[model samples]
Target: MAAFLAIIRRDLRLALRQGSDSLMVVMFFVLTVVLFPFGVGPETGVLERIAAGVLWVTALLASMLSLDRLFQADYEDGSLDLITLSPVPLSLLVMGKVAAHWLTTGLPLLLAAPVLAVLLHLNQDGFLILIVAMLLGTPTLSLIGAVGAALVLGARRGGVLLSLLVLPLYIPVLVFGVSAVDAAVMGFEVRAQLLVLSAMLLSALALCPWAAASALRQAVE
Candidate 1:
């Protein structure tokens, strides 16, 4: 327990000290979402119609931008070797790292989503549900991204490879996240979509840490 908290704190401090990684993620998210208005024109109805998909997809991509760095710093500095050999379970450490990643990456995106949604003219009725859905969904994104980050450790063009490995996996989350918001906007029952997102989060929580730990072990060996 102590080691898990320690790993999270260490990563959080490193992320804070560097700062740019998290900043880059938010900047990318804002820039990409902001571009939609220009590309699609200023049709309020059009923006409203596509807003949920645009926000969810842009958030997914923004989250991926920082994933390659999730383990790369530790792996490059040889800290990963010591971490893998620690008395504490590697899976627990991976969870700590994922938690830290979510804090730095996902949390910021969650906070930023509402503002961008307004810019996209997302229906006011869907605003609360958008936040709710992202709350259930973004951590799962971090968890799944960790496995890809771990698997691509020490590889060339790891960023590209990580995206390929994870994007397909991200589809279900994207689909349900957008669906939850859209359902709310259209006066439909959103419980089912939210339930599916919650289930995916639970499933990923159970599996991704162990999978990422195994991949990390393979990378180090």
Candidate 2:
């Protein structure tokens, strides 16, 4: 238990010390949201209609911006070797890293969504649903991303590779996440969508850590 807490604390401290890492992800979220108005023109109806999709897409892209470093820095600095040698289970270590990744990347994206909502002139009703969907959904991103991050660890142009490997997997998450908000906006029940979203997230939470750990083991080998 102490080892688990220690790993979480160490990663959180490392993430805090590297402040730009979190800020950059948040900035990307904001920038991508801002571009939507220009790309789709200044029509409120159009913006409102697609705001949920736009916000979710922006968050996905922003999260992708930081995933490579989830393992690369530690691997390059040889800390990964030390971690591999630790008595703690590798999945626990991966979970600790994923937890930090969520804090540094997912939380900021969620925090920025409301502001992004205002930019798109999103309805108040839609705003909370958007935030809710993201809160439940982005953890899945962090975990699924961990797999891609691990798989591409030593590949050439790994950033691009990570996206290619993970983006397809992200589709259902994005679809359901966006659908939840869209359903809310259209005066439909969001429960079914949220249920599916929660199910996918729970499934990913169950599986991604082990898969990522296995991929990392292979990468290190």
Candidate 3:
């Protein structure tokens, strides 16, 4: 318990001290949201209609921006080798990192949605669903993204390649996340969509770390 907390604390402190990564992710989220008003023109109806999709898409891209950092620094400093040799299972350690990543990136994006809700003219009811759906859905992004980050740990053009590998997988999250908000707007129960999002998170939690761990092992070989 202590070692896991220690690892989580260590990563969280590192992420905080070196703040650019989290800041950049929030900036990416904000910038992408800001662009939609211009690209789609100033129709509140149009913005409201598409806001859920736009928000999810921006979050997906912002999360992708941070993926390269997951292991890149450790790989460069040889600390990743030591992590692999540690008494703690690498998958647990990876989960700690993912937890920290969610705190720094995913949680912040969720926090920022209210401001963005205003920007996108999201209805109050829809705003709740958008935030709740993302709360459940974005952890799944971080989990799956950890796999892509680990897979591309040493690959050239890894950023581009990571997007290709993960974006298709992201579709279901976005689809259902947006659908939840849209359903809320139409006065339907969004609990079903929320259930689906939670299910996706659970599935990713069960599956992604092993894939990420396998990729990390291969990266170090």
Candidate 4:
């Protein structure tokens, strides 16, 4: 328990010191979402119709921006070897890293989503549901991304490879996240969509840490 918290705090401290990683993620999210208005024109109805998908897709991409580095820093500095050698379970350490990643990346995206939704003319009725869906979905993004980050730890062109490996897996989260918001906007029951997102999160929570840890072990070996 102590080691888990320590790993999270250590990563959080490193993230705070670097700062640019988190800033880049938010900037990418905001800029990408902002571009939609220009590309699609200023029509409110059109923006409203596509807002959920746009925000979700952009957020998904933005989340990917920092994933390749999730373990690369530690791996490069040889800290990962020491971390893996620690008495604490590697899976728990991976969870701590994922939690830190979410705090720095996912949480910002979650907070910024509602504002961008407004810019996209997302229906006000869907605003709360958008938050709810992102809340359930973004952590899952980090969790799953951790595994990809771990898997591609030493590969060349890892960022591109990470995207290819992870994007397909991200589709379900994107689909359900957009669906929940759209359902809310259209006065449909959003419970099912939200439930599915929650289920995915739970499943990721259960499996991703262990998978990422296994990959990390192989990377170090």
Each model's lDDT:
0.97, 0.89, 0.90, 0.96
lDDT tens digits by residue: candidate 1, 130-175: 9999999999999999999999998999999999999999999999
- Of models 2 and 4, which has the larger TM-score? 4
Cα lDDT of model 2 by residue, 26-143, tens digit: 9888987898899989999999888888888888989989999999998898888888878898988899899889988999899889988988887788877888889999999999
lDDT of 4 by residue, 1-221 (tens): 99999988999999999999999999999999999999999999999999999999999999999999999999999999999999999999999999999999999999999999989999999999999999999999999999999999999999999999999999999999999999999999999999999999999999999999999999999
Candidate 1 residue runs with Cα over 4 Å from true position: none
lDDT of candidate model 1 versus the reference: 0.97
Q: Tens digit of lDDT per residue, candidate 3, span 106-195?
A: 999999987998999988888778888989999999999999999998889998999999999999999999899999998999889999
lDDT at 150, model 2: 94
Quote each prediction's TM-score: 0.99, 0.97, 0.97, 0.99
Model 3 gets an lDDT of 0.90
Candidate 3: regions farther than 4 A off: none
| Model 1 residue 21 CA deviation in Å | 0.3
- Reference-based TM-score, model 1: 0.99
- As for candidate 2, its clashing pairs are none
Candidate 4, TM-score vs. the true structure? Answer: 0.99
Q: Total clashing residue pairs per candidate?
A: 0, 0, 0, 0
lDDT of 4: 0.96
* lDDT winner: 1
